[model samples]
Target chain A: MGKNKKITDYDMEQLIGQVLRYGVLTSGIIAIIGGVWYLIQSGAGFPNYTSFSGEPARYTSLTGIIKGLTEGSAKEIIQLGVVILIATPILRIVFSLFSFILEKDRLYIVITLIVLLIILFSMFGGLKV
Target chain B: MNILLFTLILLLGAYLAGLAGSLTGLGGGVVIIPLLTLGFHVDIRYAIGAALVASIATSSGSASAYVKEGITNVRLGMFLEIATTAGAVIGAILAIYTPVNLVAILFGVMLIFSAAMTLRKKHEDALQEGSKLSYVLKLNGSYPTKEGEISYKLKNIGGGFSIMTIAGVLSGLLGIGSGALKVLAMDTAMRVPFRVSTTTSNFMVGVTAAASAVVYLQRGYIDPGIAFPVIIGVLAGAFTGSKLLMRINVKSLKVIFSIAITLIALNMIYNGINHKF
Candidate 1:
């Protein structure tokens, strides 16, 4: 706490405000592009919209999303955008964790860390049950 | 139906969902899920997944504004997210495992519960003695006001945490943002101000939606065809709806939309009972 450099607490708030605003707007644009591509490709006729065909592996999981991003896959890119949208809030939480730590706020640091862990566990744990 | 027509129809429906949802302060996530599942005859799994993702959009659109205005208590949101995210993960897992009929019925029941809660106009958040947890965590904070800055404190930490968990579980299980339930917990049990609670709840909904979204994604519940349009449409809808809220009588619109929500809930419940998607 004593060793930390001091800055306005408002800095963290402002940074987060920008993060949430831009994350969404950027993701929204990407999603629209991906969607337009999808409709054009599938526009020939209607497929069975009622059937539940699980998306291919390349577009469903986090690693798959990253992999698809490196390659140029439209649906996968859409998924990647969705992934980004989800990641934004998680990033917000991470930002808050560091802010708490920098301020040397013990209780909030612990609480924020616990929150971070739960989110990471949920994202990475892949619990089947 | 042709792809163009299908896309156009779903887009319009989602747009309306967003407009009405945002206008009601309920978030479009709720309406879009039921709309996709019941109105459009899509699978419930896909509906939930799309709704969950669209909720992130809603959060981003609304929360950034709240944050910039300083109405959102980001610290408070982060602290409570532990319960919410954990609950969301558990609920998402539950949704993955539960039968579709059961999920639909539960969603319908939740809708009824939410509408009943909102049917009354209860805005009295009385002053209360602060809790020990609030002191330990420094959960008190201030917001801007006309006269000056008005500071507020958190109470019933234990109760707030419990309610948050329920809100999270519902969000994940149903694939909606669950802002109504979250606001109720913060404004009532926690004694946060109305404005602060709404903004903070909006801020937290994204994280909760994301926590469940990954699980849904891994399970292949989300479809690009469905999710893409839902997200874009809801985004456009909320974006415009925020602008629209200023020009009209928001309360009267809420009254009309609230009835629509009730009917949609009943329709979902009926479909669930009959095992008809």
Candidate 2:
């Protein structure tokens, strides 16, 4: 509504862009580090992916991933990188929600909330197949 | 092959897949799946999981650039994301229950459809007046052009939102970005400007993919070994390809890539029929 508010909106958009760029760059670096460590530590083993067997329990959940990281498992480190990548967009949504709140735009605040909630449900709702 | 050899080869293949994906605007996931399944003999489920990670990388990476350019309508993207995220959750669940063979068949079909879309000429239909619903939602926005700023109005919010749901389902089930379908929903159904439709679709894809990716991760499908090389390779390739896009004549390149993708799709169909997956 005011000139000051408009400047904040532009600043928020720039901030969102910065978040995406940095999030992706940071995650890529982590994944690469884990990958290099894995290759160096156990490069001789052969990989057999001809069939579908799900990942081990340790690599499947968020808590398990963090636990593996503390134990110095390279694969879990890579998974942690992936967790960061997935989190990037969710963070973007969080920033957008904040911007909407700043603008006092009730409709977009509600719309952004719906989108964020759906994503949260997919992450934590534990709907089994 | 040993893990070192395998990882190296996969890295190379994924780079090309990402390069060709961004160059053709068809996305890396489409080619990444077939390359993993038919070429490396990897299981389709693993392929899908790796592809999903690559999709998230490319979408988020590029969205950073597009958002700064100010062409992306964040508000419009957020509004449509309500449908997409819900649909993605449903599609990810369906993928878990569906037969692998059927999933391969559907993925092949989607690849063919995507190739066709790339070959078709785009028609920008920016409307002059916003619909009553669009007005209330404040969906109308302006973008910068050569001639100062040009504003556009939106129409058929319901129809566009419906198509976006389908796009989300395809993205979730197949582990693809499904940008073509999202563009169609906005550009054709919603009558958004082509520039806005594309940039906004790019902006929305990361979130949409993230929605389903969470489900995939919980089901233990995201193998870190496969995902590491794929993500690194695709992100690098896409970054290079986007830079090249400004200099190269992409018209001819698109035709060639589409043909190549079509052949790969047909092969996937054959393999699915024979239960070779």
Candidate 3:
């Protein structure tokens, strides 16, 4: 009954609760650091939210972002921080999946995996009209 | 000089929007978008992207609080997410091709529903029995209220999932939290306890927004310069508002704010039709 005992005591609520709280807290700190850094660099002028343009080719992809990070650009760091914030929920889902697996819940494992697949497909499908 | 001034204004406005949004139980996008477009003459697309950042920030921030209290039904939220994520991806992708007028009009319709839902007296407070789908998925839970720990049932799983998908698409297309639509689904269509629905919806909104945001991110629609202050301001505002919820007669305030948001949604429609851009 060790496995059964472990399943009941695993305390998914506690585990998931921590994941959410820490995920948000960590992301918040990262965003603030990036935001303040950008604020100082921009001087006193207002940001132009008037236009929509694709990011410059030099900063277009993940590689571009990594390179910019190495250069210590404030903008890249900020972008990276936002990316982390966006990833937080997805992280929670993955954590939940693992928890289900540990509990040996066959039904939940499949359900969680299906949801995970849809999210991944949405994120990566690039099927825009 | 101008950039700094704009930054300050956006920061302050987003802070206020976040505050008002949380206070009224209406997420921040409606407030941020109107302020951006009508107040600052920003493009709708940029406004949408910035709103997305702000909405996700407040949502994740508050969700952390609610999830800890064990109010959020993690399993239920995940199951319904199947529809929401699929709808969101489609809605966002469709948004890329849809004309601005259509988006604006659809936004107006969405707002009308949001206002109506907000003003309507709370019902569906009774504990529901689990549907067949709920039995299969084991979707039910309880939360501690002033009364006691109330165990509730989940009904209408199919309808709830469908509504969530639509809500997801709107979130993607408009870059708003579209939380109102989600709440409506859970409360009315799904027959879950209102408290449970609200908390679970918050937990789900972040993921729905992220799904749509992926598209925006890839397209370079998100601007770090614009999003940074907006995120910072809204997060601060929402934090303050949440703290203040204890001291205020928040229900009345929410009604007034909901009406104001409805008006702004109308304005968005008008502008979209007239091609104000």
**lDDT by residue for model 2 over A1-129, one digit each (tens)?**
567865776788899999999998889899999999988888565667897888887888888999999999999999999999999999999999999998999999999999999998998898644
Interface root-mean-square deviation, candidate 2: 1.0
Two-chain complex of model 1, DockQ on C-alpha atoms against the true structure: 0.68
Say which docking band candidate 2 falls in.
Answer: high
Error of 3 at A92 (Å): 1.0
lDDT of 2 at A83: 93
Best by DockQ: 2
Model 2 alpha-carbon miss at residue B231, Å? 1.4
Q: List the pairs of residues colliding in candidate 3.
A: A44-B4, A45-B2, A45-B3, A45-B4, A46-B2, A46-B3, A46-B4, A46-B6
- Share of reference contacts found in each model: 0.74, 0.83, 0.61
Specify the CAPRI tier of model 3: medium
**Alpha carbon lDDT at A72, candidate 3:** 83
Model 2 chain B lowest lDDT segment of ten? B118-127
lDDT of 1 by residue, B143-237 (tens): 88787877777788889889999999999898888887888888778989887887788888888988888788888888877777777788788
Between the candidate structures 2 and 3, which one is better when assessed by TM-score?
2
lDDT to native, each model: 0.79, 0.87, 0.77
Candidate number of the best TM-score: 2
Per-residue lDDT tens digits for candidate 2, residues B1-277, read 7888888988998888777777776677887898889988999989988888888887887778778878888899999999889889989988968888888998888888888888776656567898999999889988888878888899999999999999999899999989889888888788898789878987888899999999888887899889899888988887887788779998998888888888998999898989988
Candidate 3 C-alpha error for residue B139, in Å: 1.4
| Stronger candidate by lDDT (1 vs 2) | 2
Evaluate residue B222 in candidate 2 and report its C-alpha lDDT on the 0 to 100 scale: 90
